[model samples]
Structure formats: C-alpha cells, structure tokens
Target: MIRTLLALNGALIRGALAFVLTTQEDIEVVAEVERAEDIGTALRTQRPDVAVADVNLFGAGVLSAGGASSGPPPVLVLVDPRRPKVLGDALRARCQRLGFLGSDVAPERVVEAVRRLAHGGSVVDADLVVAALNRDNPLTAREVEVLEIAAEGWPVVEIASKLSLSSGTVRNHLCRIAGKTGARTRIEAVRIARERGWI
Candidate 1:
C-alpha cells in the first residue's frame, strides 16, 4: 500500500483528495494538514511514503539537500499553470523524487502522479514542462528589484528612498522596465513579470 500525506490548503480540496485517494485500494490518506506550518510535523510523525502538497505550501525549500532518510518524503506538488513562478521555484529545487501536476488536472491524473512519486519516479505535466523551458525572465537584476518593490504597491518616491536612488533615477528605471516588458503601466509590468516568472 502507498501511504500518502496531504498538505493542501482548502478544506474542500483536502476532503475531496482524501476521499478520492482513499478509494484506491493501494493508497491510504494517512494525514491531512491545512496549514503550511503543519507539513514538517506531519512528515516526521507519519513517515508517509509520499506527500501531496500545494506548491504555495511546500515551496522549493521542501526539496532541501537531504534524502528521504534525512528529509521529507518524496512530494508531488500541485501547481497552478497560471503561476509560472511557482513552477519555476519547483524546477529550481532540482529534487529527483519531486513530481509536478497542474492543479486543475483530473483526479485520475493526481492518482497517477502520486503513484509515480511513490515509486521514486519523476512526473511533470507536458504543458508545465514547456512553460519551464520558455520561461525566460527578461528583466535584469536591478530592474527585477525595482519591479518587486513596485509590485508591493510602493510609490516611486518611497521606492527611491528605500533603494537609495534619486526619484528621477527610480522613474527612469520604471520607464525602462515598462519598455523592456512592453507593459503600459507599473502594475501591468509586475503582473507580466510574475506570470513569466521573471520577478
């Protein structure tokens, strides 16, 4: 039997996952956790063979430099295709045992992914794999820094103050960022950057 732990966020998602996975004769939902903070404790305590987690909750940090004997169990991370940055984070993690599936995938796909991870195999959705390949962050280091602040709703003057740059310089950077990203507004630039996993 495959022992699995779930660390998805929503109660409905959690309940549905448990019901679906439990119906599999070879799979058992040993633990379910709603908050990101509970994953570590559940992992250590339950010692499940596989874990299914939300990308937002598990983060790339879950794939730290440790094997199953020293770290968390192999994880199958469900990602939102619209949020390429989350997928980028998981790709950069580079864990051999980790798997990826689109959040909107059919329940059978989830079951397949979980089984793949349980067998120490890697799985990634075809669309996500393509996105990972095409996702090139076009912004330079400084531009990304500026856009990050802008994305947080900071004003130009405050951003300049925080970055220790003149107001005019910050404005220039913003203008260039817009040009580079082909964005009409600061908010749009940030959104574009986030969608492409640039910032």
Candidate 2:
C-alpha cells in the first residue's frame, strides 16, 4: 500500500485530494494538514511514504524545512499551471518531486500524480513542463552567484569583495543579467533571477 500525507492550504482542495486518494486501492491517506507548519510533525508522526504539498505553501518555508525536524518525508509539490516558476524553483533548489495541476485538474490526474510520486517518479504535466522550459532564461554560474549575493541585500562593493571580484566585474554581470531578463535595475534583475531559479 502507498501511505501518503496531504498538506494543502485550501480546505476545498484538501477535501478533493482526500476523496481522490481514498478511491485508490493501493493508496492510503494517513494524515492531512492545513498549514505547512504542521508538515514536519505530520511526516514524523504519520511516517507516510509520500507527502503532497501545495506550491503556495512555499511561503511557510516548508520546502526549506525551517520548522521541520531532520529526515522529513519525501515531498511532491502540486503546482498551479499559471505559477510554474515558483514550483520549478522549489524543485530545483530542494530536489523534491513536482507535479503540476491547476485548480481545475480532474481527480484522475491528481491520483496519477500521487501514484507516480509514491513510486519515486516525478510527474510534471506536459504543458506545464513546456511552459517552464520555454519561460526559463539560462544564467551562467557566475551570474547566478552574483545574483544570489545581491538578493541578500549586499551592496555591489560588498558583493564584489565577498566573491573576490572587482566591483566593475560585478557591475558588468549585473548589467548582463538585467539585459537578459529585461529588468531595469539591479533589484529588479535580482528579483527576476530568483523567480527564474538563476540564483
């Protein structure tokens, strides 16, 4: 049997997921949580083999495991099709499984994603995957590092010092990043870079 934990911010969505999972003979909904804060505890106590998380739960820092104990359960993030960037970044940063589903996805797709994740396979919707790849702007390794430091509110001089690069070199990187992302300023560039998983 596939034991699973469900963590969703919406009550209606939670109900839908529970209803769908219960229909699968091989799947068991061991626990349900309304907030990301409860995810760690639920994972530990329930010991579910798979965790279904909402992409919006990113605000709770659940993906970062901020409040969770060590060795949390493997996670499968369910993303809204309109916001693929947020989910993709979480997947890249944390190495978690991802499955995209809009608020209007049929119950069958949700069930399929759950089953795939329980068996250790990622399940991204075809359209969502295409959108993510097409929307993504490639960034070089140095550009990403510079953007990460800049996003932390470090001044250009400070960032340059930390990275052992000249201020001019850092500024050049920022300009190139801004041009590539169509951003008007360093702050905007950083924001775009982060949204695109460049940092």
On lDDT, the candidate that comes out on top is: 1
| Model 2 Cα lDDT, one tens digit per residue, 48-136 | 76677777664353454422244445566766665557656665655444455554578787788778876777776677677677665
Q: Against the true structure, what is each candidate's TM-score?
A: 0.83, 0.60
lDDT per residue as tens, model 1, 1-53 = 99898889899998998999999999999889887767767776677888898
Candidate 2 minimal-lDDT segment of 10 residues = 59-68
Q: Which ten residues in a row have the lowest lDDT in candidate 1?
A: 59-68
In model 2, the runs with Cα more than 4 Å from the true position are 58-70, 96-103, 136-199
TM-score of 1: 0.83
Q: List the residue pairs that clash in candidate 2.
A: none
